[model samples]
Target chain A: MASRSMWRSLHYSAKRRVVSPAQYRCFSCSLRAQDQGKTDSEKMTHFGFTNVPESQKESLVGAVFSSVASSYDTMNDLMSLGIHRLWKDHFVRTLNPGSPLARRHNETEGQGWNILDIAGGTGDVAFRMLDHATNVNHDRQTRVTIADINPDMLAEGKKRSIATPYYNTGRLSFMEANAQTMPSIPDNSVDLYTVVFGIRNFTDKQAALNEAFRVLKPGGVFACMEFSKVNNDLFNAVYKRWSFSAIPLIGQVVAGDRDSYQYLVESIEKFPSQEEFRAMIHKAGFMIPGRGYEDLTGGIAAIHKGVKPLA
Target chain B: MGAVILARPGRSGVLSSLQKAATASSRTQCRQNHFHPPVQYRKQELPFRAAPTRSCRLYHSQFHPRAPTHEYTNSQTTILSAALEHIPSHGFTLEALTLGARDAGFLDVSVQLLPRGEFDLILFWLASRRGLLRAKVEENQFESLRSVSSVEAKTKLLILERLKMNQDIAHKWQDALALMSLPSNIPLSLSELHALSSDILTLAGDSAVDTAWYTNRLGVAAVYASAELVMTSQKPHADFAAIEAFVQRRFEDRTALAEKITGFKQYLGFVGSTAIGLGRSWGLKI
Candidate 1:
């Protein structure tokens, strides 16, 4: 019976309604409100570990990324011990963006395949995609657009990309836009939509996924790479220790920001699991086959993919 | 400031509407206003539940259902093709598995996807090649031999044809053989041998069901193992004709031994029966 009550509490916790603090004074008060079956307004969501007004989530996330934009690449290397490179490489190669479409657009040059990389700050995935499509596939008609909600992040990406041949060759471009609504990207225009290590920062993850579905051409792929729940208990213990204690210290030493790194770690934990996220993709009208998500590194990170159906 | 935020509420409205639509479309029970707490907070608050267990609710959730069996087979085929490129250079090492996983775009930590590590990958490669050999034999190569050849001749043809498939990876086969030679890997090696022999026998239409079944399989396995060793030891430019000759000689020796054993067994049975009859007809008992 004790276990039963604990499970009930957990179930409630998982679906904890984000009510304004004005409605419920404290955590206990919120529990009481739930017991009384009172429904609260949807004006609250989480900011790190704190429940803040929903209006503030976007800016809070923006502040966190802006604070770490310059040190983002370095921090990623330190945090994951440079395994992120292998992950990104695998991510791009899996997409193999132009292998199929390159044939259809052989007469049209490199403009046939369009890739929209959402929240791709600093052009990590974008550069890799361009390299794979150009060097590996020998197709020059693939193009990539790196979109980020934070201008600071976009600036950092633009600065880094200025040195590459793809910078101004009409093959690569950068845009500043919220993932939830990219009004500039026309419907059914993108062939591959990728969001890497960036979806957890979105205020409305489902809305972002919906936008992904809207922008993708029929039969296009939607791929995401993100930190996921570590399935192994012992590994999870070690990973948690490293993420909470060491990562923020590394951030302070390297990026001179502690709170932002703390926020990043917190956000990763708050993100949905592989199965839940796959459901979100499905809810957005994307078709997925068989579990939809593949766990990487013992579920420390995962890749989820879905295809827009051709009706 | 508040009015400015609310004045252009287009984005929020769009988001809310989209959320509603998502909730409606999702087949699973929609959690109203579900907010995931930060991991750190959850760990501190729910120590007992902090471990990442696959939840029963998740299992029952019909969110993203698993694909059918054939889709997994297709995906495995894709992974195998990517893995083949790395095997020739890296043998069957973890490095090869890593490269293959990367080429297949598996996310980090997905090395576990090939759970038994290098052994599993080696088995997969062997099985895949066996499949290809079967297709080649059935589709085009063995039609004429099937109608006119003896079982020994058919077995020789299949073994040689399969061995030829390894020519591309001859340099890497030395490393594979070394790994397979380890004491701990004996079981896996034997299993691989059994699979190969069974596949070859099936292709050759050798359907013996008596004690000959065991002998036929063992005979083919021994012949195939010896031929593999010989082929691997041969230099790249060494006479291909010599390997064929060696295989033919080995098959002939096995056939000759089998015939001699059969002849000896028949003679022993005849002598035992005559002795029994002589004892029954003996006048000493009268």
Candidate 2:
């Protein structure tokens, strides 16, 4: 048994190799440049501090998720003072991800029940929603399928959930998927679409939003919980100081990893503002007829909700 | 600023010493070639669960293993090389290069064992420096990496050389011993290994943007070789500190073209490598 164990360990050890950069193309950037003969929006990407071609962003983002998958949840809580949970909760509350029961008839199954949580690693949102849904109505089955790019996050969620009070019994399921190109759920099949702390990580936010639009059922709700600018100048200054200083330190302490946290901080700095993001959602044809901004401590975070018009 | 500089002299020894300590830790672990013994004494460490890789879908073992027993190959390198095989051309444009390097850095940093050891941790730090360097070279972020004076560069080089030599020597000795031959010994204690790795990781992270500035300069120059560029860009320094000084002194020379070349290389090299290498590995094309 001992020798067999050694042999098995040897077999597995050599096979583990460093993951190289993921390969992808920015067809949109290329096509736009070629067709219009203008290179303004041609192709651009960020490598830490430098910005380059759009094609490179995908793999860089992929690597970040892989490194952070394990300590991701823990860091999130620590860095944000557990505010991220509130942000996610705010998103869920705004989403109200369930079918409204019948009005006239004795019983009417709630419509618009399917939700796709893109980049819902570890099923944080899904798990929370499961509890919320169960509390809302036991009879009406609301399915929240989490789609994340990192398999480790999904697997971790699987391992953790199995031990949780709700496992396969919960209304939550997970799938590995890239936010830009999620093909598992059929078009116009989802009633609510959500991506929390995930939008800024994408190579192309526009492409992701468009994907969200394509998958949502008409009149579906789309809500995103992400780090947003805190409006007050004083608050902004304090936040920046905390983010650049204490956040990385916290990561070092808790996760035993700081670069991953550094990336998270940098990502927040690089992310588009709430208004600019709202504009993008509008561009995706989501009517921002009504919107709510939950500035969890001066724009430290904001949950933006938009709706796809039935027409 | 004065206090900071003053503090630097006192702190420098400790930083370098910490790195040496890390080297010592790895060496010790190498000597003790067995699974890390469960600590009867608990330290203030994060509880690590089984980290899943592509093949090892589920971690069945209870004890979180520290190092992969020679079985851990650079999967990213393999994936990249496989991707490279598909691409016929060896070179790419500036933008593509930058993008590729960024992606490669991300993947490289992401896949490595978490809480990496000192030597391995330097890679990401170097990558961040490369990114910042690229920004500076592009002139978009001027003043990012001022050319260090020859003296400064030389001094920096000396320290790095010392560390690298120590690492190489330690590794060579470990390899010669076939440390794995022992069945009962554990690798280095988790505390000792993590302390050194995290420090180097910070060091690398702090300097990555700057180093990248130099590497990016090399990457974007129509020239492919780093050594060749180093030979021409600044006078040869006796050590890392001297080189840093030289680069610092040249800060004023500020040729727009030089910056452009560096910037272009950083961006293009990164993109091209990732798109051609990783993309191909994943059976995709850019």
Top DockQ hit: 1
lDDT of 2 by residue, A163-264 (tens): 655678536677888788877778877767877777877888899999998987665667777778878898799989997898667655655445545656
Every candidate's chain B TM-score:
0.65, 0.18
> Candidate 1 DockQ category?
incorrect
Q: Estimate the Cα RMSD of every predicted model relative to the unseen true structure.
A: 19.2, 31.4
- Tens digit of per-residue lDDT, candidate 1, span A161-230: 9887798888898998989898898997887888888887778888899999998876577888888999
DockQ (0 to 1) for model 2: 0.01
What is candidate 1's lDDT per residue for B1-286, written digit by digit as tens? 0000111223577644544444444325424213344333343333123111222221111233321111123333445567788886777776666566547654212343333456656666776777787777757766655665677677788888888877767767777788777897677677668768867876676756345767888888988888778878888656678878988898889879978988999999999888887988885352
Error of 1 at B265 (Å): 9.5
lDDT at B163, model 1: 85
What is the CAPRI rating of model 2's predicted complex?
incorrect
Per-prediction DockQ comes to 0.03, 0.01
Question: C-alpha displacement of A114 in model 2, angstroms?
Answer: 0.4
Name the best candidate (by lDDT): 1
